[model samples]
Target: MEQQTQDKSTMVVFSGDLDKAMASFIIATGAAAMGKQVTMFFTFWGLNILRKEEYVNVKKTFMDKMFAKMMPQGPEKLGISKMNYGGLGAKMMKYTMKKKNIVTLKELIEMAQDLDVKMVACTMSMDVMGITKEELIDGLDYAGVASYLADADESKINLFI
Candidate 1:
């Protein structure tokens, strides 16, 4: 009798507003921390998270207003945590980091890369948003729908964020 091996994979697809993007990446980072092979596919609004300038300018869109009225507008307004207040929130983050030795989001990204998490940028969305390849961070892998599909096909855990 031949034994079949099970493949463990997690596909995190980002397609929502700023909060969603932040949440998805944080989860992906957590998954990597757990020794799992993680692949993050950024598409549509999710891809905006990869835009260097937009990372700090993420905003709530029309649809966001309809449903997430209570949510903050843009990454800057979005609290560093789900439980923190406004500007005081950001201040608290710096204080806590100094107290507990935590890393910033940019540092987390670098750590994620060091952990071998694959970050794929959707080429279709990039073209639609007029974002050139050079506009993205270096080493970001650009792929088409077929590539994402292939990833989904191989992934045992596929998520559309």
Candidate 2:
């Protein structure tokens, strides 16, 4: 009998909401823990989750600075998808998770990184959003749609968040 290889999971994280970002990272880490190859493709608003809260002091155009100023810097600054009363909802959710002994979104993200999950930033979206590599967390691969598609083609499971 021919041997089958380990499964692969590909996730496209398209939302910047704290809940969705948590879900995506949780799933990616879970799959990685299961010995599956996992890849997370971050595009558009999803890039916000990977952003650094502190400014990187990189030179940019006026539009880039404007975009940086308008968007939330990191996961901690992200608002919830629903019932976000000026960010209060997200704070409440975090408190609830802590009370329940559930992993925080930030911790989950760290776990995903430690588990060696492939994190890919969408270059096209970065260009449009004026996000530079200096603004994102370290150790991420940057690629275009074609690269993501190729990974998806080989993946046994695919999800869009």
lDDT of 2 at 93: 94
CA RMSD of all predictions: 6.6, 1.8
Question: What does candidate 2's lDDT look like per residue over 92-155, in tens digits?
Answer: 9998989999998788888998999999999999999989898999999999999999888888
**Tens-place lDDT digits, model 1, residues 1-161:** 01111233455455544345555767778877877677787766565455554433234455533433343333334344354555575667656765897665556667778878888988887666555565466668989889877766766667787
TM-score, per-candidate, Cα-based: 0.63, 0.94
| Candidate 1 TM-score, C-alpha based | 0.63
CA shift of 77, model 1, Å? 8.3
For residue 8, model 1's alpha carbon misses the true position, in angstroms, by: 4.4
List pairs with backbone clashes in candidate 1.
58-74
lDDT of 2 at 134: 88
- Alpha-carbon error at 73 in model 2, in Å? 1.0
TM-score winner: 2
Each model's lDDT comes to 0.61, 0.91
